[model samples]
Target: MQALLALSRAIDRLNTFVGKYSIWLIFAATFISAANAVVRKVFDTSSNGFLEVQWYLFAWSFLIAAGYTLLNREHVRIDVLNSHLPKKVQIWIEILGVILFLTPVCVLIIWLCIPIVAERYATGEMSPNPGGLIRWPVWVALPAGFALLLLQGWSELIKCVAFLKGLGPDPTVKADAKSAEEELVEALRQHQAAAGKAP
Candidate 1:
């Protein structure tokens, strides 16, 4: 239990770092896109591959932050029903979801995307953007994202098995206090996302 708690703490600290900066990346991407738009409309001179850059930034932002979100327990949960189930049933559902569903999905995506990205890289596929604008490879994100998901999935599986044995989830040893800083950050994120804004 202590070992699990130590591991979870390490991951959570790493998660805090990842999650904190993820918003900043989103902000930077949004700024880049807005600047590109203004340059095109007002100055009539903009990046040739700005649109593709936007897509890649958005994609990378979401995918790269996947594991951190899991570590924070911030992912959506269909717990209205599960919350009412017995402890054993709850563990089973969680185990099934993590092992059978989440892991498989990530594995399949990684398996499928790696080769596609390789083909693209090998052939030097360029975006349709003007000026022969070259694209940074989108392939890197796929394998990286899946790898993070896989690690977190393994962590969750271990903790869940311990949980089934009544050892509890990740043995979160930290005191559960909601800090003001956390609340403020969350509030701001919600506000920005809702307005199609980023920060």
Candidate 2:
């Protein structure tokens, strides 16, 4: 049990690290998009590669951050009747859901994606659009993302079981950590304050 808890913590750490870095993909995509627009407008031309790369970056960010999102408990859920349930009951429901639904879905997706990714890579599949990027890199994200999500599902399952066994704290309680939106807003406020202080 302790070993499983340790594994869960490790998985949590891995996802946290991945989540922290994955956010940069969004910035990269944004920068590429702006640059592509500027080039198209000023130079009267743009490479499909540039445009496609933006999509790639966004896709990578979204897909690879699955485990991180799960770790942070940021995924959408309805609590209309859930909040009224007993804590243990809620945990039990979560355990069942993870075991019955999340695990199978993630595994199936990962299994399905593996062969596709391999085939694309093996064939050196390129985008049909001229000057666009290769397809494999983006294709790889599907399996990679779902694998992370699957690992996270197991991590969450471990945590849920540990809590049920009185070996750990409640797994469903939201930590006091600031959400990504909150952090972004705070940074913007700081930047505004700094600009105001400037000449």
Candidate 3:
């Protein structure tokens, strides 16, 4: 139990850290782009150097939060069909989906992206904006973001395995004997209070 709690806490802390930093990236991207656009239009200047910075920040903002979203269970799911199934059956479907679809997709993306990015690095790839504004280094976002996502995926896979083992955070913890006793006491107290109010 202690080990489980500790592991959960550590993952939660890491998720929080990523979330906080990713917000700054989002705000920085928004702030700089708006400010630069205003200055460019009003003052008649080209947004050359600042453009690259904005691209990098935009990439950071968009991709880095993926893992955080996974951690929070905030990503959308199509549950219209699954809701009719029994809880255990739903879990089985989810487990198979993760193993067959989600995990493989993430793994394949990272697998392909690593070599692609490395080739860019080896050839000293730079932004192709030419005389435009930003030097768009396309590879910055994928590696870091996907690595965190991979980690998050592994943790969720662990959670699913634990559920299969009948050991993850149990839904029936509140249905234990001690909780039933407390509920009975509370019900009696409430009944007595109601009875007192009657007459």
Tell me, by lDDT, which candidate is best: 2
Which pairs of residues have clashing backbones in candidate 2?
A: none
lDDT of 2 by residue, 81-109 (tens): 98899999999999999999999999889
C-alpha lDDT (0 to 100) for residue 129 of candidate 1: 58
TM-score of each: 0.74, 0.88, 0.72
lDDT at residue 6 of model 1 (Cα atoms): 67
lDDT of 2: 0.92
lDDT of each: 0.73, 0.92, 0.70
Determine the backbone clash count of candidate 3. Answer: 1
Higher-TM-score candidate among 2 and 3? Answer: 2
Deviating ranges (above 4 Å) for candidate 2: 177-199
Number of backbone-clashing residue pairs for each candidate, in the order shown: 0, 0, 1
Q: Tens digit of lDDT per residue, candidate 1, span 87-173?
A: 778767777888889999999998988888878878887877575444436667878877777777766766777877777643222
Candidate 3 lDDT, 54-147, residue by residue in tens: 7788788677778777777667878788878877776677667767887788788888888877787787765666544322255757877777
